[model samples]
Target: MQVEYQAPLQRLNTFGIAARARCLVRVRSEDDVRALLRQPGWDWQHTFILGGGSNIVLAGDVQRTVLKVEIPGRRLLREDERGWLVEAGAGERWHDFVVWTLQQGWPGLENLALIPGTVGAAPVQNIGAYGVELQDRFHSLDAIDLETGETFTLHHEHCAFGYRDSVFKHDRPGARGMGLRGRALITRVRFWLPRRWRPELSYQDLQRKVAETGIQQPSPWQVLEWVCAIRRAKLPDPAVLGNAGSFFKNPTVTAEQCADIIGRDPRVVHYPMPDGSVKLAAGWLIDACGWRGKTVGRAGVYEKQALVLVNRGGPQDPCSGGEVMTLARLIQTSVYERFGIRLEPEPVCVG
Candidate 1:
């Protein structure tokens, strides 16, 4: 385990928000975590587990001790006629892992290429893109209870996965729901990639790739290239521009609510789900509210994509977490007032 006090976190988070951690501890293995637990004066309860720092907004200097997960390993755990079970340590970059799987002839994770963050953080956010979600490929995960220092494994049904949500995002009450939020540190994640893989081209962007490229039966590598191209065109690389990929979750509304919104605006972008609900395009709403490329303080909306919030000041004078949230709130209020749909942010706000 590596430890640093008063650690500068401006470069840690994707937003490039200037902040600091009271103490930052990098755990490279399960043994590191266990060793930390044995140390005197260590307060595990108030510790914050950090993975890739890709999907977070640092509001201010964090008072809690930051535990940066850096464990690393990847292998084909098992394989058969059905599929292969792959495992990756928590610290492994999510996008790189996805690409590695495809290069090895594993195809299930192709749709999720180019996403930022680490393998450990994937299950926490239930990260999804195109027409695929983490839950779709997830087999199980291993995490350690911070409070008890006990390691445990949770399978698909135990995860309670939802749209950009999972058990890891919720706080556990007294013997109630299985909420691991802030209480467990994920160490490794396993995925089930089937032998008979099928491509997911239901999303409009992927469909457009099919039409433009004239590749009806796209290989996993082709799909990965296309997804990377699409994301690069729409979302700014975090290395270049400080911003999360999508600022808001696409709001889902009931059929009646959808009709009400459709009545208000004929050109509202929406998609019907299998469960009879309608998903509205959050970027479209923000664009309709005239927020695209707009700036407030040091934060601004990406000119190319309305769904992304960016740091206008860059790294030299990067935006504060407060400025980002202020701009986000203003955008949310405008969208709500205009469309009657409350937009939810995709990134977690931390301090």
Candidate 2:
């Protein structure tokens, strides 16, 4: 474990919010985490866990100790007639891992290409893209209990995955009567890629790719390329214009609410869920509210994709987390007032 005092965090987060951690500890392995926990007067309860820093908003200087997970490894754990079970350390970059799986001949994760953040953070957010959620490919995960420093494993059912949510995101018990939020530090994740794979082309972008390429039966690699291209075309690169991709979750509404919104604005982009609900396109809503390409203080909505909020200012005058949240709140309020649906922020806010 390596520890630093007053660590600069501007470069750590994709949003480019200037902030500092009172103490930042780089935990490279499970042993490192145990060593840190054994330190005298160490307060696990107050420590903030940081992954790839791509899915967070630093609202202010973090006063608590920051545990920057850096554990690393990836390997094939099992393979059978059913499929391949692959495991990856928490610190591995998510997009890299997805690409690696594809390179190794796994097919299920191709639809989620180009997503940001680390493997450990995927289950926490139940990260999804195109047409597949992490839960769809998740096998199991190993995590250290922050409170006891003991390791445990959880299968798919224990994760209680929901739309951009999981046990890791809640402190209170959910419908499943269990929540692991702030209590567990994920160390490794396993994915099961079935041998019997089919293209996930439910999303319009993938369908368009099919239309453009005239390839009805695209391979996993081809699908990955299409997803990456689509994402690059829509979302700005974090290195160029700092942003936490897809600032808001696509809000789901009841069928009645959908009908009401449709009555008001027929062009509203929506998709019917299997559960009889409707998922509204958050970007479309924001764009309709006239927020696309708009700036407030140092934060601005990305001109190309309204779902992304970018830091318009450079490093020296980057957008403060306050400015970002202010703009986000404004957008949320306008969206709710217009559509009678609340827009929920996707990133976790820390300080």
Clashes (backbone N, CA, C under 3 Å), per candidate, total: 0, 1
Error of 1 at 172 (Å): 0.6
- Tens digit per residue, CA lDDT, model 1, 75-161: 999999999999999999998999899888888999999899999999999999999999999999999988778999999999999
Error of 2 at 52 (Å): 0.8
Candidate 2, residue 320: how far the Cα is off, in Å? 0.2
The 10-residue segment with the lowest total lDDT in model 2 = 170-179
Candidate 1 TM-score, true structure as reference: 0.98
lDDT of each: 0.93, 0.93
Flag clash pairs in model 2. Answer: 62-351
The TM-score between candidate 2 and the true structure equals: 0.98
Q: Which residue pairs show collisions in model 1?
A: none
The residue-by-residue lDDT of candidate 2 on 1-351, one tens digit each, is 899999999999999999999999998899998998898997777999999899889999999999999889999999999999999999999999998998888789988888999999999999999889999999999999877888999999999899999988878566435677887899999999999999999999899999999999999999999999999999999999999999999999999999999999999999999999999999999999999999999999999999999999998999999999999999999998988889999998897
